[model samples]
Target: MPPGGRQVLGADLGVVDHAACAGEEPELFFHGDPGAIALAKRICGRCPVREACLARSIANDERYGVFGGLTADERQELQGRRAAA
Candidate 1:
């Protein structure tokens, strides 16, 4: 995927306009490879709807792919921090 896995969420594609990851290889977003994950995150770093993408991932508890420049574990840590705060 380009970054935040645009096409994978065809349903939410319309929700987050101009997804940066659009048309990219979806597998890149879900890859177990660290390098691929980093590439996806880099793609997400340039995305306009990054916060929105992250919000959606957090809201849905998405646990399998990169979103909003964060890996699943990162998202969990973010949520933990938010909860603690």
Candidate 2:
């Protein structure tokens, strides 16, 4: 069983489960206010699978919402860094 009550295939194949934000409202991550972004980052900072979440978001080119404590712009910057490396 994967996170968020969903059974993802290859759970035993090194797939990282992401359930830390399952119970959080979607608005918390997508809001434009800095306070909301900070709250979302705080929640993400405590997540065990934060790295995996960010990796996935980056790989998928996520254009909105906060993932792994980073906003879209942050992720874009990270992508740029990765590309530059």
Candidate 3:
């Protein structure tokens, strides 16, 4: 996938889209501080593929960075909810 998670055409199938973060600087998502996490979440909040991104992160068990506008703690909570259901 290209940087910034832009959609790409599959060689013999439908269009494939990447996460919005793919286009952004890697540091923006990986910064290990509260302010950086907040900024990254703000960016993700406006992403068109926020749901997909979050779902992918959760399914993949991502251990760091922001995805789908949520922090690691938030994702963990969500995972808990999913397990409860």
Candidate 4:
């Protein structure tokens, strides 16, 4: 999938769609709202896909929202810390 979660659908890949960015843009809203983030974090705290989701967010350098229950600024800080280390 593309970094922004956009993907081409169908066998021909000619049609345009956003299925990958669907389902839960909510999942990426932790940066925009603290209360929502807290709620999502509670759920993600126990989700099996948390690691996978976090990995994707970091790889994508997601800058506008949250993923895996982490805010954009938090993810950036993590990246910075890793780079510094």
Candidate 5:
């Protein structure tokens, strides 16, 4: 059993190119596409470790695609609100 309903880190890995993520100019998770983001949110909705995953992404400053079903901007916005509080 894994934390994210999968047995691996990159399991069910979507189309977001990791190379682009690792590169200097990272691609935005969800590609700034609302439909894709909605799909991602649906996936995240069922994740067992959703909170842990989201927290990890925020803490690590993940600059790439969605994590715990949240887009990069959503995560950043959440992080900002958390910091403000």
Candidate 6:
């Protein structure tokens, strides 16, 4: 819900417990470099709440950074594919 796909929440916020990216650098998610993106995706690939993260990303119309392992363009293509399907 914050910029760069990074959220700063207290332990009381349950999302903290399940978000594998919670403590990762926000820049890691927002950087435009290909290597950074790959790393971000790898992190998301193992995340327990990947689908939830993607759903939230699409729901919020996130236009930047990596969310649920997909880049914004990748997410857009995924949406297009779903529509076509």
**Which 10 residues in a row give candidate 1 its minimum summed lDDT?**
1-10
Clash pairs detected, candidate 2: none
lDDT of 4 by residue, 3-73 (tens): 54543222222221322323455545545566877766666665555655666667666786656657778
**What TM-score does candidate 5 reach?**
0.58
Instruction: Please give the range of 10 consecutive residues that has the lowest summed lDDT in model 3.
Output: 7-16
Residue 77 shift from truth in candidate 1, angstroms = 0.2
TM-score of each: 0.81, 0.76, 0.72, 0.63, 0.58, 0.81
Hey, what RMSD does candidate 5 come out at?
9.5
Residues 1-85, model 5: lDDT tens digits: 3342433354333432332233332233446677766666676676565665666676567777788777777788888898899
lDDT of each: 0.84, 0.77, 0.72, 0.59, 0.60, 0.82
Comparing 3 with 4 on TM-score, the higher-scoring candidate is: 3
Among all candidates shown, the one with the greatest lDDT: 1
lDDT of 3 by residue, 18-62 (tens): 445657788888888889888898888777778767776676677
lDDT of 2 by residue, 1-85 (tens): 3333343232331434444777789799999999999999999998777877777677667799998889999999988898899
Error of 4 at 4 (Å): 6.3
Off by over 4 Å in 6: 1-16
Candidate with better TM-score, 4 vs 5: 4
Candidate 5: residue 31 Cα off by (Å) = 4.2
What clash pairs does model 3 have? 3-22, 3-23, 4-22, 4-23
lDDT for 10 (candidate 6)? 25
* Order of candidate numbers by lDDT, starting with the best: 1, 6, 2, 3, 5, 4
Model 6: lDDT to the true structure: 0.82
- Residue 5 CA error for candidate 6 (Å)? 11
